[model samples]
Target: MFAPTINSLVRYYHTFKFSHLDAAIVFFSFFQNMNF
Candidate 1:
């Protein structure tokens, strides 16, 4: 049913949350390099 979909979404959310900071840093640096 929808349980598997919900579980996968939850896991993906947690992984994204943990990597959020790192992702932001990398994203900003990438843009900065492009701008310069």
Candidate 2:
């Protein structure tokens, strides 16, 4: 019952973490481009 919800939440957390890292990398590259 509750197990499915917990599993989904855990998966979502991992996805969010990866997305956050991706955003950071993109932002860093954009900043470098602006500086150049």
The C-alpha lDDT values of all candidates are 0.63, 0.63
lDDT of 2 by residue, 1-36 (tens): 557755764576577764777666755765577689
Candidate 1 regions exceeding 4 Å error are 1-18
Q: How many backbone clashes does every candidate have?
A: 0, 0
lDDT for 1 (candidate 2): 55
TM-score of 1: 0.48
List the candidates' TM-scores in order. 0.48, 0.48
The 10-residue segment of model 2 with minimum total lDDT is: 1-10
Q: In candidate 1, what are the lDDT values of residues 1-36, reduced to their tens digit? A: 557755764576577774777656755665577678
lDDT of 1: 0.63
- Runs of candidate 2 with Cα error greater than 4 angstroms are 1-18
